[model samples]
Target: MKAATATILVLATFTLLSSGKKFRWCTLSDLEQRKCAELSKALLAVLPLATINSFARVSCIRAQNTHDCIDKIRVNKADAVSLDAGDVYSAVKLYGLTVVAKEIYEEGNCVFAVAIARRGTLDIQRLRGVRSCHNGARWTSGWNIPLGFLLARNELLWDEDQPLSQVISQYFNASCIPGVGITSPQLCALCQGPKSYVRNKNHFCETSSSEPFYDSEGAFRCLKNGVADVAFLDHLTIMNGTDSDQEEYELLCPDGSTAKLSAYGTCNLGRGPGRAIISRHNFQKITKKFLTLIQHLFGQNGKERAKFELFTSVPFRGKNLLFRDATQHLQLLKDKAEISHILGLDYVALLKGLGHEGSSLDNSVVRWCCISNAELRKCEEWALNIKSDPLVCVQAASMTNCIELIKSNEADAATLDATHAYIAGICGLVSVAAECYGEGCAPAAGRTKKLTHLADKALPPVYAVALAKKNARHVNIHNLRGRRSCHSHLYSPGGWLLLSRYTVGALENNTVNCDIGSAYQSYFWKGCMPGADKNLCKVCIGGGEMEGAKVSSRCAANHNERYYGNMGALRCLVGSPSGRSFGDVAFLEHHNLLKNIESLQSSGWAMGYTLNDFELLCLDGRRVAVTDWADCNLGPVPPNIVMTRPVTTTKIYGFLMKSQETLETNLDSKFHLFHSQKYGESDLLFKDATQYLVHTSHLDYQSILGDPFFQLAESVFNCTHADILEFCKQDICTS
Candidate 1:
């Protein structure tokens, strides 16, 4: 009778003490559930000491998988669950769950995914027919990060209409991606299932341990057994899996180089976010507080660690039971933190590319911005012809206006010169592709050879040259202090920036503060600089004036200014139909130097001038033939780039690539992507010399423009109180 009374009194006291909120933790498997139950018992023992107003009771809820846990949390059946970074993306994006805490490892809240292969057996660049091993389907370190890196580098091309698995299966000879099952048999070819397939059941590609090659360790074992060429796993797994013969295996870097297994910090595919604990949106605060309290009691440095270990799964005989064993502690996140902030913009973009959030490539019409009517007409014609991937033409008055339009989302993309590309990047736009000229897209071996490889293969840099008539013997590069000059535009890379850097910025007599415009005005005689004011516009001949009429098009930077672009500047030095040349020297790009001279000869503007009539003024005070621009040019200019809003970069690149592929395959198509002859113009929508467009999404404006040019641009534009810089600054502030 006395014992029964004590038991009843204890039960009543327990019911009264546990009157706080309850935290229901969702578990994926039976082992995880058992771990959770132990955790609950440990929390109960510390409830009096660690009690918080938010949560004082702990409960365990079982789910079949991560997706089921996500659903259970959404319906209020569970309060929280720990998930991998890749699964966290789906939970936040698809289910609208909130991340309350993150698992911080020894390397902080991120892990590096590395590619391992036998030394000298594989290269990252040559993975076409190589056998590959992955941790699991849609896993962060194994499947997503490495494959996403490949797609970003243009090594893999995927059509959004089909599953990404199909593309992966076709790209590799064989792969072992457990959980993918028969959907991609090629991906399951190397996975080892249970010994008894018919009697014990077929677990060929299960995500569970039934499949021998399932997680990071299994994937590495697949490589160790000589069945795979490369194994994609996390750095921790690689470190744990290697033995005394670890020197025999090497890491495959994204740059096509190999490194020792210990160089994972620098040689890896990508840095991925750490696993996180997620909860329903309304349960975030409670979950965060509860997690903080429990972690303090049973974490790595827990005060009550003698009673319970929260991070380990040794007793459960499992790996990563409730949380990753590698987790150092649980980091509570700020209320405003989102998945994108945790996963980072590039990784979020990669997940989107994998069709997790949505299809990166959409059917929406891409709006291509055109600054002039000629370009608009050409764009409309191209759009009409390429009906499969639709394009809408958006007209703007100038390149600056096009930048504003694209920033405001009114326009999708526009091709801009190197100078304008810099301004666009400053205005929050990104480069997706760049124009490739000459024989190919690869950098030429030497200046004498236009291209060592075929055109359409890579992007070749354009050369800037100073052109002068061969008949002018008195005027040379050294004595051009007071000579009339013609420039493509105010801040054009080849025409103005490079030319002024070597002249006004170099000469002791012409050196002023970093004011390039003031230096140009004081150094050069009356000349046409298009966008400059006063004496700079004195030699400009408007489009109407070129036809022997007077108009306001004089000094305008567009086509209205007859002497505005490379060809226009060439026309300024080549003389009019009446044999009256306005400028003594012209600064332009060398790619179209011969072509522009030929076009001028055919148009009767340079009746007496042949290719030999013009010569290049070398910076060393020596004159050479125009064909010798390889050694006599001002500097090598980067090719024009296609700029767009950050969100539409991949989409616009896909549209343009598809359009180019269509034009290449259809020989009888009337539209010409590079040529502007049909429009009675030269370089309308794109440069007339542009052979093709190469994907440059991996590079930024600073990288695309090269270090020397970028530095020169900063000195020329940022140093001066120029109107373009002021406008860009204002745009940035407003944006």
Candidate 2:
């Protein structure tokens, strides 16, 4: 009888104590559970002395595991509970949840929601009637937080130890009680702790018109259903929108009918709040550093505050597991200015070839920097491969620095250009498979054109931002002002034709050539740090980005040694003082072809250097007339050193396909031309006769075109070495 009477006394005290207008929870929910557990002995330092019994059990739930506590609360076993925000619907269709409004706990990770609806979907006058159908209610992250916020607004309190019926009666208007309906009690009960719940529908609720609806999601649905004249709420929904559902919402903010949004209001206010707590023992033993770290970590700015839900799947804490909802590719799109890119290697060439045909390809490609030599072999085998899309690899690189260059706009667009894709691969980024200019291009600075390996069908054109042509006409000249002009340094068609022309045109043909080298070097080390660590692999050095310069310098460094040859930067021909000549460098190097051909033009001088680079010296104007040199014989007569040399156009292009190979066979081909030849060695090598002519296969011309042994003429051109080589050989030699 004394125990029963004691219980009655306890209950009576709680009732009378909670009846007044003030209700500040002395004890919170989630924290109380740990204190009750014997396992948390040392950690539960909050235990009060003097036999203080906490009759008011906090109903707070820190996580789903706290549902057991919520169950105890529902059966009158405990006082109140706390929960996080996961129980809400955050999908495309944001739903409305009718929950108790009490602000118990808030933090960066989770916040207690007061209420939410699609933007502009709620009416202020109609907010009182929602959830009139529930007997008792369930809770979510801050069902209690919101309750506290609102009840505090009206300066009311729930009668303590009283049924919720009696508690709510004191706070709510008499008429509002009969109309109260809860969001989802069943789901709320089932989702015990900090889980989220969607109140409205499968899709997010839309605000229509200028009125505040009681239940955000449902109010919007009600507005759409025409039950209400206007709907207004929060959740970053459109303050103004043009979409179908957007038309239904008309914003109602501060100052009643005024259209402007004074504050983000409920949308911005209910965000998670931060608090400082540690193990009770730790709290008593707080170090300044620990407090500082916590303050820094939970601060109101930076990535920690971003609170990206789906992005947090992988905790970035050295866990080797990757979690992504990759089931739907298109659904991942966000309404932000972001671009998804594709980056890889030589494979980008294939993507680009496809783009040249006016087909839709990837939006962009990195560069020909990602393909490994081994991958090149695989590419050869998968020449016609439709399964291994280069863009897919490019997409993978978009995840990091591996993606080299990227197009400016669009958050989720796919990059299709192979060159761009390869650059992405080198940088380690990811993007979707794009069918852009880089799509069909090889990851390497491979074929500017398509390959016979792939099938005939051309790739589709990639879509990109299109500006008015009229605007382009006036602004075309300003394009390079602040742009980074780039190209391979060693001579090639791309380097020569486009880059050289641009350089020569910009800087003009200068004698010192200082500006010319400066311009090209700008591309070399501008983005590169001085004494740049060789972060890039040689395999990525096709067409001599840095390799061409390095090779020339190293070889020039050692000239007298047995194997010490000269400039590997070019192919050359030695011209004798007697006006006779013989091939010096291998045909593949072709520097000599460009070097001294013009020496024989007007004066026929055994000149030291012919600095006139690919100038249109001899032109009929009908087409371009050049001294052809690819496959044609060094034409007729007694080896006149200054006479225009002949070459083969078609065969040279074919040879180019085989020229850059590092194989011994290709090496033999470079020397075979010098070896099988019949010539007086000294006439070309020196003014004297009979030197090393009768020895091994024609004095390996590769060695003869020494860095300093240039007895002929040399010149620089405004075309990539490949282009100049192909242009002169095809146009001049094919004749």
Candidate 3:
């Protein structure tokens, strides 16, 4: 009767405590319920004794496990709870909870996670059909560390559409995973129902201590008793559990190194940062004050340490409550950002690995990125020749989109024009290979000996040229103002840079408009500059967009544009009827016009256009014949460079180097590997006039293009407010 009265009195006291005024501390449910009660009792005795400026009364709340406690904190049902490193990641990402305090242990503030097996019984790669034991799903020492590495190597299959827990169950023959949901029977197949709930069979695999193999010690015992062939647990648990018989177990490192359990710190997969006390981001100050007060009274040198051994001993009969066994005290963390830095990037990778399963990008394939349907067709042929073992083409909407794909680990490499290369370099991509152009009408056979690696040779500059009809109304370069013009794309060196330079130089003395993008929009009467802003695209005939694509002229950026690439720009110069058909002048590379003009001028050609009618726009403002291009063309432009992210550069270099060897050796084939013929276009991946691919290592934007040219490109593009210049507001390469 006296015990019942005391319990009633405590219940009434808790009922009077408002959530806003008191800290609701959460602990693991059931057996840990008494531990929660004990922590509350310690806080009651310690709050008055500590010298903290702000006093916070702490109350205890029981939750199913660490995740449940996190959910409680997220919903304001509880204020804080100490959790494992893996659980802290979930709480931070899923609920935006912040780490207020970290638990300090005697052995170390951190512990390594390892895979253990009976000596000579298992290896990391040969565990396909073996029974497994885990401390729990998403645990740092058990699941995330070891499993994250396996998933990265594709040793285990992964399917993101299905439950990650279900995928794990399918990988192992049978497994005991405590705290995993019972929605999938495969997860619960090997579980022996806990003794506490014999009638509820499904509750056997729960995270509570009632389950046979639920925690670090439980998982080790499961392996010891022959319930599982391999067990995932912490180094501390393995060292303590196997101390009685050293020869009974050995640690399995992914590198195939095996050693006694004591060497686990060195032989383990990875070390997880120690458990942390987390709270809602807003309640950090109050949470820190309450924990500091409790740590002072129950810490190693506390005066009232006898009331509750908060750090020295496990609270009550449970192994952990607000603090773990052998913990010295709690250390306050500044903020969530500091907590992320303490956890480190590799530990964050392990948490991310939990969500990824057998993704195709986790392979050795050199994913060649394409930005258009036309380029994709050519990429498909390249994929077929390589047979897709180590090389495959992945497509995105634009070059900028392709760079983003590399950042996200989706695509690997792409052949980018110099303009795109500058943008890619700003995004931290490295130049792995460059298209080497020499004096050749086509790639010469038996010239494989001259093909040097990217490091040995530099790409020859290609000249930019402006073309116009010999008998056009606007006769020369000086007459470009108020006349119709055409361009490949806004960023193309030939189409935009050369023309932009002339426009700015011609009107430099005028102060009406300093903005180049706006100036070009108003300068040209009506033009088909494929990728320009809406005003520049008003005269575009709308054939550039993909079928079923949105009805917007700005979408005419890639091959879909009537005047897109060098070839597309040349085709635009070959006029059509209906008045809006063609521009009076076209800007493109010198070689692109040479390859297509002879054919377009032939009566046999479908367009009925003649090269005889076109003339070159010279620097002296005079029109010249096609044969006099060497004397009339604009500045020499930088060549295309094969680029990939720095992380994947080496792997892609090896793959591309070998593919280039095969293509050069078989250069005389009816279907040329270096050139594309699908849409009567010769160059898609490499220039049709490209003699070979030059191997380059450790080459950057400023190095390959030269500092002066890079600055010139930067300045020229800056005139029109290029995205690359904006992205390079600071030196992203050095940063």
**Candidates' C-alpha lDDT:** 0.76, 0.24, 0.67
In the range 1-735, model 3's lDDT, one tens digit per residue, is 955754454343343343337668886656566766666665565543431222235567776556677888999999988877877877787678888877776555676788889999988778877898888777878788777556544565554446667777778888887877767566556667554444333347776566768778778888888999998988766555546546888988766768888887678876677677889988887677666555555678765788877663343555544566656667777764554355654355345435522334455466778877777888776766653245677877666677666654578788787778888777656777777776742345644533355453456788888988777846688878887778877777777765666765423525544566677778888777877775566556554323333455343767655456776667666654333457778888876566677656442223555667778999898888887878888777788888865444555666776676665566564445566655455467677767666666445666787665587666655445666444434321110
TM-score of each candidate? 0.66, 0.19, 0.56
Cα lDDT tens digits, model 2, 456-559, are 23322211110111212222212322322222122212222223333344234454442433444432322111111131111111222222334322211111
Where in model 2 is the C-alpha error above 4 Å? 1-40, 43-62, 65-409, 414-419, 427-493, 496-519, 522-735
Q: After superposition, how far is residue 329 of candidate 1 from its true place, in Å?
A: 4.6
What's the residue-level lDDT of 478 in candidate 1? 83
Instruction: Give the top-scoring candidate (TM-score).
Output: 1
Compose the digit string of candidate 1's lDDT tens values, residues 1-48: 955754454444344435665679998667788999988787667655
True lDDT of residue 125, candidate 1: 91
Ranking by lDDT: 1, 3, 2
Question: Which portions of model 3 miss their true places by more than 4 Å?
Answer: 1-361, 387-390, 440-451, 454-457, 505-513, 544-555, 577-580, 601-610, 666-670, 717-735
Candidate 3 has its poorest 10 consecutive residues by lDDT at 726-735
TM-score, cand. 1: 0.66
| Ranking, TM-score, top scorer first | 1, 3, 2
